[model samples]
Target chain A: MRLNLRVWRQKNGGSEGAMATYAVDGISPDMSFLEMLDTLNEDLILRGEDPVAFDHDCREGICGACSLVINGDAHGPERTTTCQLHMRSFRDGDTIDVEPWRASAFPVVKDLVVDRSAFDRVIQAGGYITATTGSAPEAHATPVPKADADSAFEHAECIGCGACVAACPNGSAMLFTSAKINHLNVLPQGSPERETRVLDMVAQMDAEGFGGCTLTGECATACPKGIPLPSIAAMNREWLRARRKVKG
Target chain B: MAVSGLIMLGYLVAHVAGNLKVFFGPEEFNAYGHWLRVMGAPVLHHHWALWIVRIVLLAVVVAHAVSAYQLSRRDLKARPTAYVHRRKRASYATRTMRWGGIILGLFIVWHLLDLTTGTLHPGGFEEGKPYQNVVDTFSTWYGNVVYIVAMLALGLHVRHGFWSAAQTLGVGNARRERLLKLLANTLALVLTAGFVSVPVAVMTGVVS
Candidate 1:
């Protein structure tokens, strides 16, 4: 299949960026989106032109490293990560517009790459269960209810891909922050710091300059892991409960 | 923003119920209007109850607008550069929230001036005669135009705002999502229809 691509090109974080058009021919239908980009890059290298820059690791789609907004939709028209998106999702000779994740919190570092360390800071704020470093404890010692365990596992699917921020019109990180909060907050092991977990994480989220949730559901829609939109409401409940229980 | 919005929603529910009384004829309608001022009469001074409601509503409106302004500024700032290949995302009601809120705010000013204070009433404004005052205002084409447009904006605002408030307050979840959406739609429709009914009645000479 042949395709026309309009890819974002930026020299560095401080420089201006624009979409540069390229035409790639002889693309295979089974080739993943990133693989298709590889073909384009190989052609660029053969011509001694600077190849387009993008983020990708664990091309299997679990690393949360691949970030691209294809044709105005995060991860292209597909709901999966860009690495998992195949060329068959598009028709032959179709033109695709590719751009980096757009959010002030996730500043564009280069062409299709944005600095996502803000997510790391948010996680550092609270996304953990405190316990002394020692041997692994017996599973029976901390019994978790089936329902809570299931809920925790559900939220644990979040890959921290930043697609939620990319898709949200307000560029809110509520979904990602909420996912991490809920992942641990639901388990019996996570009860020790439940109050601080939500309160501190939300404060860190706000401090990161991320916008507030408007419940538009864009984040959930773009989420590759299918983290439901209600995760945000659950987080809000935790935050409010913590605020009431732990007065400052 | 969520708390203030819900407070205003509660006020709107009562406001619409009172507005429906206009169809009962001038005596009944005017009496209801008088009752608003005389509510809690024996226990409280005259118009004191009304003043209290007015004060609370004024405060809610101020809070709502202030937070909305702050949230909008932050939201816009959070995304300094917009995507070049923009596609339609959320529902129309969701997208129009900011502008719809502004319209409703402006409509409140005009509405108070037109009827409450008799400052912008097209015809001769009379105090203690809300029944005729309503009719006089609706008699003008622009009055109906402005009112109906605002009411439409109100419907859209409430449709998104009610569900949004539930989420913000953490009262909404996966199980309650359907029920909350239904309630939001019903509330929006009922409020818009009830308020718009007054102007429709006046224009049709049913209340005049």
Candidate 2:
């Protein structure tokens, strides 16, 4: 298949960026989106031109490192990671527009590459359970409710991709933060610090310069892992309860 | 944000119910308005109860508007550049929230000017004549246009905002999300119908 691509190119964090068009001939429909880009980059490299730079690893789809807004949708139109999106989603003579995640918190580093470390700080705020460093407790010792465990696993599916932020008009990271908050908050082991977890994590999310959630809900829609929209609502509930706890 | 939203939501529900009383004829609707002013009479001064409620409502609106504006600025700042391409996956109501909120804000000020203060009334500027005020405001075409349009905006805003606020306040789960959405839709529809019917009634001579 022959494809036309309009890719965002920026020299550096402080440089001006624009959509640069490229034409690729003789591409396979089965080739992954990244592989198609690789073909474009390979041709550029042979011509002594700087290749397009994008982040990708563990292309099998769990790694969340691959980031791109294909055409207009994050990852791609099929609701999957960019690395997993095959060229077949497009057709011959298709003009694909790609850009890095657009969020102030996640600045563009280069062509299609963005800094998502802000998510790490959001998690570091309180996305954990306090585990005792000793012999592992018996599996049966902690009898967690099945409902709680299932809910936790549901939220745990978030891959921390900035797609939610990228897709949001307000660039809110509430979905990602809520996913982390719910993943740990629902577990029995997470109960001890539940109060502080939401308070601190939400604070961190705000401090990271991410926008407040307007509940647009595109984040869950754009999420590759299908993180449920209710996750943010649940996080809201937790935040409400935590706020009312009246910490001494 | 969630708390302030819920307070305003509660107020909207009550306000709509009060508006619906217009259908019961002027005596009842006017009496209802009068009763509201005397609600906490023995314990508080006349109109003091209404004043207290207004103060609380004012505070909630300020908080909601301020947070919304601040959040909007942060949102715009977060994306310094436009995406080469973009697609909307959220509903129309969700995406149009900002504009809907602005329309509602402007309508509130106009509504106060027309009814509460009688400054913008086309008919006699009779203070405390809530029923007459309603009839007069809707009797004018522009009044009806402004009011009906604002009601529609309010409906759309509440449709998305109610479910969202409920979700944010932790009132929903997978099992209850559908019900929450249904409630949101029902409230929006009912409130819209309740508010819009008054204008329609005036135009049709039912309330006149």
Q: What is the interface RMSD of each candidate, in Å?
A: 0.7, 1.4
Can you give the DockQ of every candidate in the order shown? Answer: 0.84, 0.73
lDDT of 1 at A86: 97
Name the runs in model 2 displaced over 4 angstroms: A133-141, A246-248
- What lDDT score goes with residue A207 in model 1? 91
Query: lDDT (0-100) at residue A117 of candidate 2?
Result: 93
| lDDT tens readout by residue for model 2, A1-248 | 99999999999999999999999988999999999999999999999999999999999889889999888788988889999999998989999999889889998899899999999998888988887869988988989999888888888888898899999877889889988999898898899989899999999988888877778778888999999888887888898889889453
Judge candidate 1 at residue A122 and give its lDDT.
Answer: 96
TM-score of 2: 0.94
lDDT of 1: 0.94
For every model shown, the clashing-pair count is: 0, 1
**What overall lDDT goes with each candidate model?**
0.94, 0.89
Identify the leading candidate in terms of lDDT. 1
TM-score, B chain, candidate 1? 0.99
Report each candidate's C-alpha RMSD, comma-separated, in the order given: 1.0, 2.0
Candidate 2: tens digits of C-alpha lDDT, residues B1-208: 6678779888988998999899898899989999998999799989998999999999999999998888789888877777768665578888879999999999999999988888888979776678988888888999999999999999899899888888877887788989989999999999899889899989999998
Cα lDDT for residue B25, candidate 1: 90
